[model samples]
Target: MAEDMNVSKGKLQRDLGLLDAVGIGVGAVIGAGIFVVTGVAAGVAGPAFLIGLLIAGFAATCNGLSLPN
Candidate 1:
């Protein structure tokens, strides 16, 4: 694989380690969910709003994990 590359091109470097990568991905998902769903969930469910988010996340995750590869 190394031999297939053009040696004249600059090498690419990884700036994020595994922890940073996972944190970034999780942060984006949580941030988007908070922005998109927080107000509506609050108005609808009041103090128990988080249960809806948790249930939806659980269902989505289960569905995702059960899909055929």
Candidate 2:
């Protein structure tokens, strides 16, 4: 005798819109770049660290977009 097991398997909803997804990606790249590049940027560019951060972020975004997946 098999008792009824109400196992619900539903598709997870996609709640994030395009802008929200893009913003999250950009924020993640910038956030990670801060820690990873701060020392290098400070050593190389001194007061131009902010520009380094921007370039790093842009490069990260481009890299992310170019993936085959």
TM per prediction: 0.41, 0.37
Worst 10 residues of 1 by lDDT: 5-14
| Cα lDDT tens digits for candidate 1, 1-69 | 645754435676447899999999999999999887878868888878888778989999999889686
Considering every candidate listed, which one attains the maximal TM-score? 1
Write down the lDDT of every candidate, Cα atoms only. 0.82, 0.79
Question: In model 2, how large is the Cα lDDT of residue 61?
Answer: 95
Candidate 2, residue 46: the lDDT equals: 82
Model 1: CA > 4 A from native: 1-37
Model 1 RMSD vs true structure: 8.7
For residue 18, model 2's alpha carbon misses the true position, in angstroms, by: 0.4
